[model samples]
Target: MGERAQQIPFYCDGSYLCEPCAELCRTKVQRQKPVKTKAYKFNYQCQCKFMRGGCKLRYQGEEGVVLSEEERSKQKEDYKKYLNEKLLMMAAREVPLNRLNQQQFEFSLESNLENAMLYDDEITRAVALSCIPPEIVDLASNPVQQLKELVNWFKFEFFSWCDKPPCPSCKSDQAVERVGSDTPNAEDREYHASQVEKYLCKNCKTTVRFPRYNHPMKLFETRTGRCGEWANAFTCLCIALGHDARKVLDWTDHVWTEVYLAQWERWVHIDACEPLFDKPLTYEKGWGKELTYCIAFSSKEMVDVSKRYVVDPVLNRMRRDRVNEKWLADTLQQRREALWSMQGDSQAQFLRKRYQIEQGHLDAGSAHKFPSEPFQPRQSGAQ
Candidate 1:
C-alpha cells in the first residue's frame, strides 16, 4: 500500500473504485484539513472571506447597528466627558498615588535617556556646540558651567517655545490662538498625551489639534511647547549628558527639572523654559507664583521637593490640602523605602544619606539658597 499510494486514484473525477479502494479514499477525505478562511476589518465592519460576495454576516452580531460617523463621534465625546467627571471625583476623594507609581516607574526604567540620546543625534549636538561660547566649553569640567552651557544650547539653539501653535497654512504665530481643549485622539494617546489643545488659525480659518505629548522622543521633533515639553525633553537630555536628573512637576501650573550636582552634593533647579540654572526660588521670589507642591521624579525615587521652592513653608502648608498631611508624608516615606529597597546596599545607603542631608537643608530653611549669577532674561521669550 505504501509504494502503491502514488498510483491511488485520489483525484479521480467520477471513477468508481472497489470496496477496499473506496474505503481508503473515504479515510483520506476524512483526514484531510479544512480550508482556512480569513476575516478583516473594513470601514469599521468585519468582512468574512467565506461570504466575501456582499457579506452580511457582520449584521448577525452586536455590530448589527452600523452607526453614522456623527453618531459615533457623539458617543465618543459623551464617554470621554463621563470618564473625566469620574476621574475628578476620585481625585477629590484621595491622593493620586498611582500617578507617582506609574510616572516614577517610567523614570526608573531610564527609557527616556536612551530615547533622548537617540533623538538628540550627534549632528544636532555638534550644531549646538558650534554656537556655544568658548568660555563655556573651557569650563566643561565644572558641573555648574556644564549645565549652563547645556541649558543655553538647548533653549537658544535646540528648542523653541509655543505660547500658541503657529498656523499651519500661513505659518504665523500671531494669528493662531487657542479655541478649546478636547480629549486626545488615538494617535495622540499612543504618544502619551493627557489633553489635546485646539488652536484656530485666523488667516486660514483652520483648526489644529496640538496634542501635549509627554514622550521625549516626540518632543524632540515638535520642539515647541510650554514648560511641560521643555522640562520633559531637557530632563532626558540632562540624563544623556551624564548628569543625575529628574523631572519636577509643580502642582500650581509649572514644570522644571532638578539635577544632582555631585561636586555640590545637592540637587539644583534647571528650567529649560527659563534657561535658568540653580534658580530654585525664581518662581516664588522672582515670578511671585504661589507654590504649594513640587514633586521631583527620578529613576531611583519620587520626592516631595516642595520645600526647595516655597519661600514660606507655613503658608505653603495651608495650600497643600489635596491629601491629609500625615497621609501624604506616610505615602511618600513608603514610596522612598520601596524604591530604595530595589537598589543595592551601597546605593540604598547613599539615597538614605542624601535624603537625610536634603531634609536637614529643608529644616534649616536653606534649601532655597542659590549662587549669585547675573540676572538673565528668559531665553525662550515665554510670557
Candidate 2:
C-alpha cells in the first residue's frame, strides 16, 4: 500500500514488504553468483561425516565380534592344517613326476655331456673363452647371475610353444589320430606314462607320435610345452645347474618356477610363459587374481608361499579359512610324510636338512614379515 505498486505475499522470513520490493529481492537473490572460494578443508568435524564421508583412518566397516585369543590360536592351527594338506597334495602329484624324471635325468645328461656345452668342460670352457662376451661372463660371478644368463639364453633357445610337434615325415600342420598305447615302445620306453599323441598326417599316410614326455630332457629336446611342463622342466634345469629350485603351483590354476636365491635367502619366482623372472606380482597385481594358496614344492619340501604374491594376507586368508582347518591339516601332514617316503630317491641327508628347514618354515608363520618392495603390476592386456 504505502509507496508500493503491488501487494507482496507474506514471506517465510517475516520481512514486511510490498509486491514490487519482494519481487526485486527475489531477482537480486536469483542474480547473486556463488562465491568462488577455495573448497572447505574438512577434518570431519562430525561423527556422521566420519562414518559416511569415507575417512581412511575410520573403521572400514562395522566391527565384527572380537575373536578370543584361544579362538585365534585354534584358527591359526586349523588354517595351517588345511593349507599344508593342499600343499602336500600338490607335492604328491609333482614330486613323483619329478622323481621319475630325475631318475632318467642323469642318464640323459651323460649322453649329452659331450655335446652339451655346460656339462662338457671342454666345450663349456671353449665357449666361455670365445663365444660369450667377456663382460657378460664376468657378470655371472654367482650361481644366481649364471642362472639369469641361462634363463635368458633358454628364452631364446626354446622359444617355440608347440602343442603338437609337426609331423617330421611330411611336415604337415594337421592333427592325426592321437593313439595312447597301454604300454611303452622303444623310444617312449622310459616315458611310459607319457600320453603319446599319434597324429595321422593328412598329407602323408604316416602316423606321427608326439610323446608328451614329462621329462625335462624330452622338454629340452622338444623345447616347448604348456605351463606345467614348462615349470616342471625349467625347475629340473635349475636343479641340474645346481641352483635349488621348486615347482610353484597355484590353487587358482597356474604353475611357475622359483629358484632359491642363496645370496638373498629367498625364493625368486620365474615364469617361462610370461618369461618373467623375480616378478612375483605378475599374478596378483598384474593378473588381478584373488588367490588363496600358492604352494612351492621341490624334491625335498613344500612351503605355503602366498606371501610372495599377495600383499594383503588378511583378506586372502579369510577365503583360505573357508575349508576345515583341523582335518585338512592332519590329512595333509599324513599324506606329505607318506609321499615324502614314497619318493624313495630323496637322499637321507637332504631329507633331514629339508625336514629341519620345513619345520622352521612352519614355525615361522606369516611368511614375508618384512615383505618385499611394494609390487606394481605391469600394465598390460596379457596377464
Candidate 3:
C-alpha cells in the first residue's frame, strides 16, 4: 500500500515525512555532492517522493529520457500558445480582478495609512518610533541581516503571539481536535480558502473557532497559525518596518516570506515556522528536498523566484509543472507592469531597483548561483 501510494505524486500537498523516510527522500546524486531535497511539512505529513513517479516534490524523475529536436520545437510552440491563452484569460478576468484589487487596496493601504496616522499623532507616534533600531543606518553592517533579525524579533515577540488560541471555556492545555463546521466568509471568494479550525472544548464542551483571516493586520492580532498565518503576519510587520517585504508562496503547499534587502540588492528568504532567516538552503541542503517554484507577491509586483531557491535551476525546473516557463515569465511581467502603471512615478525608483533584480534572474546567459547570498570579499584580504 505504501509503495502504491508513493507512485502517485503528492507534490507537497500537506504531507509529512518521518525522519527515516525524509533521509531516504534525500537520494544521493553523486557521493561527493550533498543532498538537496525537503521532506517534511511540519510534523504531520511527509513530502517524500523517493524516485517514485518523477518525484513531483523535487521534479526528480525518469533520468534517461531525452527529447528530440522536433519534440523541443513542439514544446516551444505549446509554450507560446499557452502564453497567448493565458494572456487572454488574464485579460478577461482583469475587470473582476480589478474590483477585487480595489477591495483589497481599500482595506490594505489602510494599514500603511494607519501607521502614518500613528506617526502623525504626537504621543502614539513617538511610542511606535521607539521600536526603530538606533543602529539601522550603519552601512558597515548588512541591513538585510538586520532586517532578518527584525523579522525574527517580530516572529518571536509580536506576531506569533501564542502557540494556539487557548481554549476559551477553560484555558485547557489539551487541544480540541477538529470536530468542524463554520460559515464561509467573503475571503473565501476574494483571496484563499482554508479549513475552519473548529475545536470542541474537552473540558467545558464550548466550541472554539479559528477563522482563517486573509488580512495581514487581522492576522497580527490573531497571530497563531501554521506557515500561512505566520507568513501573512510577518509580511505585514516587514511592511510596517518600511521595507519591501513580500509573502512568498510555494506551490508545494508551503508559504514563507522574502524581504528585499537593499543592502544586498536581493530578496532574503525567511521562514517563520522554522524561525529561519536568510537560510535558503535549509530545505534543499538540510532537508535534502527539491523545490519547483516559489512565486513572490506584493501589492506592486509578482515574480517567479524558483531560481533563488535551489542550487541548480535546470535540475529543479523539472519540479515545475502545470505551466509553461515562458507563460509564467510573460504573466509575471504583465502583472508587474499593470501594478506599476497604477503607482505612476511615486514608486518608479523602488520598482526599478526591484526590476533590476528580476531582470538579473531573466538573463539566461548569466550563471545562477542558486539560493546563495552574495558574498562580500574582505577589504584587507592580502594586507
TM-score of each: 0.62, 0.50, 0.57
Candidate 2 deviant stretches above 4 angstroms? 1-141, 167-189, 192-210, 318-323, 335-383
Query: Tens digit of lDDT per residue, candidate 3, span 22-86?
Result: 33333443223223235433323344543334432343334677667786677557655654454
Q: Candidate 2 lDDT, tens digit per residue, 1-383?
A: 23221122333232333222232222222223222223322221222221222222221222354567786677557655654555454333311224444445334322322112222234323432343344445654577677677666655664355555577776755645545443447677563224566666666767676665555555555666566566656666666555667777776667778887767755677776656777776676666676866766654455557756775555455445323444334534553565467457656455556556645653464234544345556322221
Which of the predicted structures, 1 or 3, would earn the higher TM-score when compared with the native? 1
Candidate 3, superposed: residue stretches over 4 Å from native:
1-142, 161-164, 173-175, 185-195, 349-353, 361-383
Scored by lDDT, model 2 comes in at 0.51
**For residues 202-293, what per-residue lDDT tens digits would candidate 1 score against the true structure?**
88898988888877767777877888788887877666555778887787678888989888888888888876777777777666566777
Question: How displaced is residue 75 in candidate 2, in Å?
Answer: 29
Give Cα-based local distance difference scores for all models.
0.64, 0.51, 0.54
How far out, in Å, is residue 117 in model 3? 18
Candidates 1 and 3: which is better by lDDT? 1
Against the true structure, whose TM-score is highest? Answer: 1
